[model samples]
Structure formats: structure tokens, C-alpha cells
Target chain A: MKFLAEINVMPQKEILDPQGKAVKIGLQNLGINQVSDARIGKHIQLQLEAGSEAEANQIVTDACKKLLANIIMEEFEFKLIQL
Target chain B: MKFLAEINVMPQKEILDPQGKAVKIGLQNLGINQVSDARIGKHIQLQLEAGSEAEANQIVTDACKKLLANIIMEEFEFKLIQL
Candidate 1:
């Protein structure tokens, strides 16, 4: 089966996100003061072929651990759907 | 009321994603050949104050148009949840 994985890699909450902070400031500067905070991260979409759903899950998890996310500073989660 | 918006800004399909291509090559180098393609984009979370859901939606849509997305090179979508 073919599957698509939508992965989100986000900085750990305890870590400071300079990019997000900058975005918040930018928004405020644009006169959008209602925004209290912003957090920025990566959205990765993967297209892969797998024999089954379980196999697809395993592949995506390994990809996240090995390449997609920096476990030390960022965490990742993904939803896999058959395509 | 307060709302949180989970936004994704992605390169338009016609555009090339060098970052994602790099990731795909890296994954293949690591022996993960099942992945056929990859695309990387931005994930942003915004925490904001609004009077109602409709108002919050308008605020977020405006943010996307004015700043969050380039509109020319990329496209964006977001989900807003009351907090």
C-alpha cells in the first residue's frame, strides 16, 4: 500500500523558540495585538510505499527517530493515511 | 475567549523543496529507501484572544494573508480551537 505521513516536529516547550518569538513581535508590529504567543516548527509530508499499515507506521517512526526530528531539542508526531 | 491556531504553510506544488529533497537523500543514505518523496513546510501555533469564534477565524485569516503566507510561492491552512 501507498501512504502519506504528515509529520510535525516541534521544539520542546522548555526550550526557547527564537523564531516564534520573532513572529510574535512581527505580528504585534503589524498591529495584531491579540496574538499572545507564537510557536514555530516544521511540517513534513512523506510519501512512501509499505506492505501494510503496521509496516508504514514502523517506517515513519524510524524516519522520525533517525532523521526527521532532533530528539534532544524537538519532538515529533505524525498521522499516516493510505493514499 | 481565547483561541489557538495550528497553521501550516507549504510551498506550492509547482515549487521545488530543497530542504525536503535533502532530507529524502539523507534518509536514503541511511537505508530508508521506501520513501518516494518528501516535502517540508512551516508549522505555526498561535495563541490569541478573541471575542467569538467567527472573530477569531477572521483574525487568523487576516494574519495569513498579511504575514504568515507569501501567497505567491506558498499556500497556508489552519485549524483554530477555542482555548
Candidate 2:
């Protein structure tokens, strides 16, 4: 079976996103007064071959833990679908 | 009223994602052979004040068009929620 993992890795709420803050300042300078806070993160999609759904999900989970995300600074969530 | 916009900007399918390609190679080297293709993108969350839902949505759309995404290489989609 082939599967796709749609992953979202977001900075922890307590963490300061400097890039986002910089963009926020830019927006404010543009007179977008309504804008308050902006947070930026990463979106990733992975395609893989697996023997079963469980196996595919497990692989994705392992990937997130080891390489895809930094657990202390960012958190990851994913949805798996057969492709 | 306060609103939140959750936005995702992804590399177009026709675009080659070099970063994703690099990550895929690394994953393969780690023996994660099942991994075939990987695509990376951005996720953004914005907070704003608006008079109405329609206005909030419009503001988010404009932001996406002007600052949040590069239209030639990426595409964006967003969801708006009242806060």
C-alpha cells in the first residue's frame, strides 16, 4: 500500500517566532492595524510505500520524532491517507 | 470581533522542492527506504480584529496575496475562525 502523510509542525505556543514577529512588524508598518500576532511554521507532505496503514503511520511518527520536528521547540501533527 | 486565520503555503506540484529532495535523500540514507517523495511548505497563523466575518476573511485573503505567499512558486489556502 502507498500512503501520504500531511504534516504540520508548529512552534510551541510559549516559543517566540522571530520570523513571525518580524513579519508582524512589517504588516503593522503597512497600516494593517488589525493585525496583532503572526506565527509561522512548516507544512510537509510525505509519500511512502507501506505494507499496511499501521506501518505507514508508524513510519511517519518515527520520522517526526527523529528528523521532521524538534520536540522541545516544535510540535507535529499528521494525517495519513492511502494514495 | 477578533478572528484567527490559519494559512498554509505549499510549493506548487509542478515546482521542484530542493529542500524536500535533500530531506528525502537523508531519510533514505537512514534506511527509511519506504520514503519516496517529500514536499515542504509553510503554515502561518494570524490574529486580527475585524468588523465581520466577511471582512475578516477578506483581510486574510489580502494578507496571503500580498505578504504570506509567493504566488509564482507557491499556493496558499486558509481557514478563518472567530476568536
Best by DockQ: 1
In terms of docking quality, model 1 is: high
What's the lDDT for residue B35 in model 2?
92
Writing each residue's lDDT as its tens digit, candidate 2 over A31-73 gives 6778899999999999999999999999999988888899999
Kept native contacts, as fractions per model, are: 0.87, 0.79
Q: Which ten residues in a row have the lowest lDDT in candidate 1 chain B?
A: B59-68
Best candidate according to lDDT: 1
TM-score each candidate.
Answer: 0.97, 0.93
- lDDT string, candidate 2, B1-83, tens digits: 99999899999999999999987988887778899899999999999999999999888888878888899999999999888
Model 1: per-residue Cα lDDT over A1-83, one tens digit each: 99999999999999999999999999988999999999999999999999999999999999999999999999999999999
